[model samples]
Target: MVTSATQVLFPERIYQCEANIQLIAAHPEQGCYVVTDRTPFHPVSHIWPDHPADRGTVVLESQVHEVVDCLVGAVEQESGQLYVGADIPVKRDEPGWVFVVVHHLAESIESSVGTKATLNVDEQYQLALSRGHSGGHLSSLALNKVLHHDFWRKDASRKDELGHYDFHSYAQTESRVTEDCSTDTYRIGKTLRKRGLNAADMIAALPTIADQINQQLAAWCEAGFPVDMRREGEALTDSRYWRCDLQEGVVVEIPCGGTHVTSLAEYAALRVEFQLINEQELVMITHSQPA
Candidate 1:
């Protein structure tokens, strides 16, 4: 009965939905974990962990439960064994695994398996994250364009959608999204040098590069380019893409699962600062404040 509704079939895509409670279990360390037949919660990805989990309230009957953390959980096809987050042994979409979003609650409830529940995400927090994520993508593209004419190996096979050398894609190590900003780090070590990037030149031009990136981002915001999210299906494992038409006459499509603002118009200003550390590590800090 907890799994009856069609919406529960792909809870991750539901965003906001009312669904039956499928299962409730006690966790040894993380408190109570609730699995609804359907939900709108965005669980922390075990693979990427970039966008952070969605925070929301789960209302059951008249009592509301605060979802402290949302996480990805998978059950084995043959054994029905459950693994959460880092405990999983295989990659996502692995054969014979059922993926589900697990909402962490502080206390266990005595509700029955088919109890109806409502999922509501905090709008303010979601909006901040959306702006941050969108700005992060924009800043990456701008960074690539700023460094396009120099420092890249002419024969570098990778290129951005706008024909610029894809420095962001090639050198990016880790990216993390915060309230109004995203920080990305890159390593310009021996491997990057071998790939035709002039690391010395990049380090020397850090300030100029930052200015160029900020200018490009400001122009993009002024143009108010359209941003769209493309979903292949409603399932958690389905492919999704963030597509944007830039003022620079380039249509960029990047595979992304996180949420984003509807357009560049939502941002008043988008700026990026660059820092070169240890003569080999490059850090790009992007900040976005919504209008």
Candidate 2:
């Protein structure tokens, strides 16, 4: 096994694990950051930042330190230098660089490297994030279908993972996933206009369109399909995707670099609300919870 950089425990959705601390560093502003040889904590990605960080606790020498945040850290193999979050240079999975999860604490710890450590993930909060992330993906897919049937038929080249008109992919400006909810924002500009998006008519049919999307989500949830993550490798920077088989021969898969629930049963009910701002920006807020 490689020992210089941390290994990410993905495709397992591990909640807690015991690993050795590889490095301990002090940051002037964010307090201290501890790196482990293996971790279950999913850090807030600097590249996307759509889903927030995983907040948990780390035990070092019998002292429990509250991990306020988690972030992606990169190390230079040649220089032995470390860069955290946005400060990191080079794209992820870049050659000659290794990525590690940086657990941020509120204060510094007088610890040394190679110390045995315990990682405890806040299970409830992590579940909430997973729900929101999965719900966001489902909502986007439903929205695409609704728009394709109601507004316009998109060409084959302009389609999403499930072969629906790529409305969300073309117009979405930002997406944020939080506890039991996710918000998606889309900008209706010239590019979207060329793709058959009629801003005025779309704004007028908000209620009807939202109802259609919700109905689709309800049916999918009713099936209680299982979800899984597909990855190319076990490395921290490896390609990962989310896959859900809503029905036989109707599976949906998309590229996602975040966490998700193993089954739709966790989200007994999922719904979305829409709003138009200044006739230019469309906002969608999806709320999900158990029955």
Evaluate model 2: give its TM-score. Answer: 0.95
Per-candidate local distance difference test: 0.79, 0.86
Q: What is the C-alpha lDDT profile of model 1 across 1-291, one tens digit per residue? A: 212211222223334678777767687776688877666677778899988888888888888889999888776757656677898887667877767778898778888777888887766777788888889999999988888888776667888888888888888889999888999999888977887888898898888888888999999999998788887766566777889988567678899878788889999999998777778788899999889
Task: Write down the lDDT that model 2 would get.
Answer: 0.86
Top candidate by lDDT: 2
**Where does candidate 1 clash, by residue pair?**
8-37, 15-40
Stretches off by above 4 angstroms in model 2 are 1-3, 153-156
**What is the Å distance of residue 169 in model 1 from its true position?**
1.5
Error of 1 at 172 (Å): 1.2
TM-score of each: 0.92, 0.95
